[model samples]
Target: MNLKLEPGTLDDAAHLAELRALAMRPSLERVGRFDAERARQRLLQNFTAEYTRLIKQDGLLAGFLVLRPQDKDLLLDHFYLHPDFQQRGLGSATMELVLAEADTLGKIIHVGALRDSDANRFYLRHGFVLREVAEFDNYYLRYPQHVPLRGV
Candidate 1:
């Protein structure tokens, strides 16, 4: 499958908000925090075209990703794939790109997953180390892995 990350636009907010609601519903519901309106509003409030990307699979919109650069770290803020796209390796492939960007910038990556969400395992598998357990969320960090000089 051909995958690409295309820059997002302000006009894409509404559509993306709906996508976020759909993508997060299961985990949110599992935690008893499912509020479609709240999910959409939260995403809309922080939507940044500069940091957002529309994930395309074979020329169709499959999901969205939001990676923001903080002082010395990068935040994996919002990553959502359509229900149909889940468990299809697209998320992993998208993560590889995100991680590569973090590696290139030598920045630590931060992400949070809802308590009991499958995403927690996904993050851990991709080298994220659990650092904090909040009331409803689990935070993780991934430090950049630098290659050592052959002779030093």
Candidate 2:
């Protein structure tokens, strides 16, 4: 699959919000938090076109990613792949790019996955260490892999 991340825009918010709701439905329902309106509203409230990216696969919208730089680390606020695109390595590919960007910036990456969701495993597999476990989410942190100096 030809996966690419394109810059997002304000106009994409509504569509992305719907996508988020759809993509997160299973996990949300499993945790008894599946309110469609709430899910969409939550994303819309903090949506930032500047930091969002539309995940497209060979010209079709497959998902979205939202990475925001924070004081000491980068926050991976949103990452969702359509059910059709899940388990096909697209998420991992997208994560590789995200991790590379974090490494280049020398910043740690922080992300939170829904409690008991498969995303927890995905993040852990990507080198994110479990940092905290909350009521409904598990937070993780992945430190950038810095290259050693040739001569010091």
Candidate 3:
């Protein structure tokens, strides 16, 4: 199926609410009924003039990608395709857009995922180099790119 990555808008807040509810599952499983509302609030704080996007397949909110709009350096945050959409290459396409945009703008990007997350492996395979572990109780994994990856 074809995919679309379009800029997120205030209108998409409800979809975000829906996604955040699902997005919290892994964290909730780890932390037990974690406060996703709080997480959403915290996440929203990071939203700036950056051009965020709601990933769509056939015009549905299949997933989303948010990165710093101006910097070559970006934080790929809250990227999740629905459970039904997972394993369907939608996530990959979204990420490729992130990298393509980075490469176009001549910037590097960095992100941290949970150490045990499948996303960590995905990032590694996508040219994100493991740089360091992080602080905080959960001890996240840090991955970084200094430029468009050499081999693609």
Candidate 4:
């Protein structure tokens, strides 16, 4: 299995959108899909570059990650893995890549875990601490504790 993160192109928009929709629905039952749609759009609009990645095992996008930088924080804007990709370590592997990039830039990584998700647990296992829990969701940070060291 190999994972890669690279700039996403216009051609990836549709697949990326579909991935977001599939990954978000379980959490966005009552919410509209447009939320993720708008966020993705805004991301492309503001940044001259968009970082999109895929976790591939035998040439399929098993999982995906996206990020946008702000101030000193590399906000993990999006993450998704097809159900088949879940629990196979691909998500975790993809995240290690994301965190490593943030570390090289000396940025603290901040991610808002979905309001109710196993994502919180996953983040915790990965050396993140719960900074705050909101009615809407929870925030997590991984720094000094497990901040990415330079990667290969």
Q: Which candidate, 3 or 4, would have the higher lDDT against the true structure?
A: 4
Tell me which of candidates 1 and 3 scores higher on TM-score.
Answer: 1
> Tens-digit lDDT track for model 4 on 63-112?
56667776767777667787777888888887777777766677778888
* Per-model lDDT: 0.94, 0.94, 0.66, 0.70
Question: Model 1, 19-85: lDDT tens per residue?
Answer: 9999999999988899999999999998899999999999999999999988879999999999999
Give per-residue CA lDDT, model 3, range 1-152, as digits (tens): 78888888776765675676676567556745467676567556665424567888998878776676334356665677777788888888778877776766666676766554577778877777777775422222223335645687
TM-score of each: 0.95, 0.95, 0.76, 0.76
RMSD of each: 1.9, 1.8, 4.3, 4.1
User: For candidate 2, what is the TM-score?
Assistant: 0.95
Q: How displaced is residue 124 in candidate 3, in Å?
A: 0.6
Better of 1 and 4 by lDDT: 1
Candidate 2 per-residue lDDT over residues 75-131, each given as its tens digit: 999999988889999999999999988988899999999997899999999999999
